[model samples]
Target: MPGPAPRVVFLGLDGATEAVLRPAFERGWMPNLEALWDRSATGTLWSSEPMVTPVAWTSFLTGCNPPTHGIHEFHAIDPAARTIIPNHAGRIRVPTLWDAISESGREVVSLGLPMTYPPPDVRGIVVAGSDAPGLQWAFAQCPEFGEEIFRDLPGYSHKVLWKRRPRTLDELRSVSLRNREVFRAQAGAAERADARCDWSAMMVHFHNLDGIQHRLWPYLDLDETAAHQPEWTAEVVACLRELDEAVGRLLELASRRDAAVIALSDHGFGPCRALVDVNGLLCRAGLQRRLPYGTRLSYRLSRIRDRFDRWKRRRSPEGTSRRGPRSIEGEVGCDWSRTAAFAPFGQLCGSIFLNEDLVSGSSAAGRTIGEIIDALRAAEDPDTGLPLFADAFDVAERYNLDPAAEGLPDVLAPSTDGYQAMAKWAPFSRSLLRPDPNLPATHRYDGVIAIDAPGVSPDTRLDAELPDVAPTALALLGQAVPEFMEGRILDEAFDRDEASIGTAATGGPGIRPARRPIG
Candidate 1:
């Protein structure tokens, strides 16, 4: 007979990267993280192809690629309904880590995990993150837990207002501070829950780091000779220090429960130099249709009105407000009937959708796709003569996509730079590529991951990918790794016998006949 299984605690820091954390750790700004890295196996956790939050985290949870998990991007388009639905847990086709662990008779508590909105019916407690519109329906197993959180913590928010751009440094500081406070409260709540409940695994996610990087990347990445240095840099540093403290607290909690600790991020972060309007290019190629003359006139007038309104707001005593930028789709409506191919907005990639109605047959659609791909490949920056897109993928060939999947895009357009591909079909005064003043930071491919467990080798450097995390975690819990999962366990990070404990099982959720004993 084997002893009891070790509890596992996963701390997900959104957009955490070695580029930021390495410097902070070396400067002694993050002692807890430094200590964990010193004693644990640390490595770069590669993100998904487009490296968006939803897709990467989904890959982390499912041990499967985007195709198997069925989450290719943030927004899934419904062609028949002509609507875009936000990705959520309901969209996940495979069983997640939480489901497997809970089914093995271990209690799990997940707090503030993204893409978990409309929380699944697990054997344990789950509180959804950003996708939930309100705090009321954030929790699935425990409604009172959310109520207690709201009542206890003042200015408690499950998700920060990421879309809103700060007009002033003070406004940015205010938002960052509020989000930091919310993270602190959530971390404290997670610690308490772990202490009270009989949980085998507890996962907590923090989004403030990602928010701060997005809003203050200009200041954070500045040199001493920069033209203007905002006073809010100190606040950003303070928020990071607070995050470090939260890690320390969680580490202590994990220690008390005799749990192994794993700290990781879904994706990395970097400065976004410019935005590429892929839809505008499509319009130029005559692939995307233009609005009617009357509609175009109305749109021009609306833009004038909007500019006037913004000018008035800037001149007002209050100065500019923090309203988010309007969606390009809403601004320039797509004429689907005449359009052949159109790129839809995503975080760091634009998914090009072919209009099936416009292209009658499959052969014609293939020809249109080939033409669009050729055109995009031929496109070059007039100023630098550089390729606009880093890579373009045929969805069906690259991802082994299900041909029958609804709302699937035809092509994926990832920008050469880390900027988002904007879907703007209308012509504008600026060049095709221009600096996005509103959003200065975006995601990168190399995320951060650190694992510290008993019997695991110390000071080890492991090479890992996003999908590998789920199976490694399952192996830690002595659960069988599903054969359908595409990732392999990190044998280098653990002792020989421990690493070999996982058995590959086929079939679905009911395939696990019995839980393996903890080695």
Candidate 2:
């Protein structure tokens, strides 16, 4: 029989930050996580630029940057059409550990982790996260388990999605319980899957902590009374405590001495006091012309307002209220056809990539594109007179830009720390620039990384560079790092006494890029 297969469990807590977590522990909200931190090697995990979920998590999975993975931001613009494509649409170009483990004949269970949409053909079960509605139902259609998993979820998703939409202190407590219930079901399934399979890695991503921070952060600071209410503090603490209990439940499932367990977050959370309107700034600098003067502010206001209306509409019947027709304003300088390179980072910021046909060879289009980037880089902030972006990276210098990707955008514009870019054709608003001086909690760069087992560093500090996490996981799994993965494998995380696992080159077994159909 093969030597005992190491069981690895990754608990991904979305938007979990050490700032809130550390304090919450002091107050006894997260005793389980605090205990895990003390027993395991723990430190702040750094995330890549734009610090959004999809970008950071994708890098965490593939161990490659957006350029190499072809997922630059939440939204990617087609260089030729300049139209927005869903950030969640593309497949990862590189191999992921899920693929690697499956190739080694190990089974894995992934629950509620994003970007697993159009699920990969792995050796185990993969249920795409709840972000995609009816995901369990969708996965049920997969030939793998047939209806086994789906048969159990309809009764669960109600408590999973709605019961946890906390609105009050009492509701917060109830949400916690609901989250625990969902986790219990998911964890039990994972354990059963592990027992039946040879080797397994189960990942569960929890979002309760993130929801609290987003709604309550503005009100936590007593200094800022506008957004704060007296009832929010206790609710935040309760949310943390709830997460701690969920952690305990997960730990119970894999308490094996040889099993390796990890709890990690893609990035941490904080208050959003400052909001930079990049599109507005660019227009003021004359780099981008604003919508024609007649353009109404409603066009901009509608973006924010429509979300609430849509949510209500979804909850209410289709035509209950006097719903007015949605309006569309015109673009000033944007050429929908010729404009290549778009920013798709959750509307928080933008990044650009070029199209294939336009940027290849001696096309004048490619030359025009380079000039556009140069112009963008030179553009300055009208108010502060500072550069529009932090820095622009060449595709070759900063990313694994496709060699044959000639028409892809040649430049990638990553925003400054707090400043994010957007490209809506509307007049700029300074009101959007004002920072929330009253925010109690604020966003920080600190993330969570916890590991337990033999051969790993007991306690150590880790570099925040996005490249480090993947190589670190590869090193732990006894896999050789590919030269294409620019990040260095973290050798320091292991102890010399622990025998290094075999380095057999098990090429990843999963989907490869589909060939374009020939006419």
Candidate 3:
């Protein structure tokens, strides 16, 4: 008989890539991950269409596409108010992996997973990641238990590691020190969770690596001067070494539970050479128009909720603001009647929202959308003669959605390699392209996923996307995959399956089985 069900441990390395990991492993900076890599089935985990953290990680949690889960980007647009708002834990339209596990008479200890602000009520421990306003609001259960960890863990935070970009070696050191502190805190929290509850499954996410790669890409890459700087190199190595130590501790815990360990990332990392001004291109192409009565009371009225939210966040116990994004669209008014389309917001990829009424009930299959796609595809940097968008495709078609579906963008434009979308729209904004003055790197779709467990083939290759992680984890844990999930179990990774894994689940709260005639 099967000895209960195999436990699972998920370790999320946010924005991790082979370019960095292979090198870090070769240097022996991350011995723990290297050891796991040696025995696991490794492959590229394709990210969401946008390849952004919020969208990709949300997909990982739900095992559903953006349309099914209802989160396409980090910030969602309140269609009624036409106001942009932060996408939070409450926005998920389906049951998450944690919920699925708890519903199956099991418990989960999910720590610091992205898009988990205002943590949901679950059977075991759950804490918010970068989305929470503060730790005060991050706990899902046992407030007293979580508060103890928060108080004891030093330099723990749910926001950016560095307040400013590290421009010098000294600044990099400061960022590294703070990052190591955060790593220790999260690792400590994982340790404490075991003493509190015997969880069936556990997931620990480390997000600082993404920020580090983004702000310190030059130093990580072979930039000659930046790579050769001993002080800066030392700081990077020290910071990642601390992260490796923390991950090693968790891997030890997995061994104690005899759990199958799965390591993954939301997306990979790469250097950013330029920023594509999304809105600037739209305005220049005569797709969007500005309001005649520019920035005034009307603009402030639309953003009053954001103001109130900020005020409320400030008054929270931690006093740290998890502020929603404030972009030029909120400050500058738009002439909706005359505008055919507008860019709400974006980072790695651009999102374009067409005027709903103008486009009628047809979603991505609209004449205006086609014209805009043509215009976007034709755009090129006059200075460098390089195309702005690497690919411009319909989100609905890409995600295989109903043409009449709502709450999704009409088109998505992804920048070419080494380019990121900057949806800047302001009265004074100029040019279709500009030098990115902030982070030097951005995300790619080549995130990683590796599973190390008994009976799994060594050195096996996995071909999967973000949503596949959750379903595969469920299958490994002896649970039926929710029927709504589009991903399937990676049967190739396991050699001892007797055809019971990857079965579809029946009706549940977040899922309603479709009607079918019995034979």
Which of the numbered candidates is closest to the native, going by highest TM-score?
Answer: 3
Worst ten in a row by lDDT for model 1: 510-519
Residue 247 of model 1 has an lDDT of 87
Clashes of each: 0, 13, 0
Where model 2 places Cα greater than 4 Å from the true spot, the runs are: 1-5, 79-82, 130-133, 137-199, 218-230, 293-346, 352-389, 394-397, 400-411, 423-445, 464-467, 480-483, 497-519
Evaluated at residue 408, the lDDT of candidate 3 is: 61
**Tens digit of per-residue lDDT, candidate 1, span 306-370:** 56766776677645422223323444555667788876566567678887778878789788878
lDDT of 1: 0.72
lDDT of each: 0.72, 0.55, 0.75
Cα-based lDDT at residue 350, candidate 3: 74
What TM-score, computed on C-alpha atoms, does each candidate reach? 0.86, 0.73, 0.87
Q: Using alpha carbons, what is the TM-score of model 2?
A: 0.73
lDDT of 3 by residue, 62-164 (tens): 9887777878777756666556667877888898988889998888888888877777777888888877766666774568777787678756666668555
> What TM-score should be assigned to candidate 3?
0.87
Can you tell me which runs of candidate 1 are displaced by over 4 Å? 1-5, 162-165, 222-230, 296-332, 335-337, 382-386, 402-404, 424-430, 496-519
> Which candidate comes out best when scored by lDDT?
3
Error of 3 at 195 (Å): 1.3
> What tens-digit string does per-residue lDDT give for candidate 2 at 1-519?
022236777888877877667776776778888887777767777765556666777777776766666665554443344343345524577877688778877777776676776577787777666434444443632435425555654323311343223456676556655655665555555555555555567787775456556555653342333355556566555555656776786777667525567788877766553545544443344334444556545445645454555466556744322222222212223322333433223334444444333344546545644655675677554576766455665555445445224333355565554444554422435443544333223334567777665555666665444555555555556555555564544444445354443232113321112211121
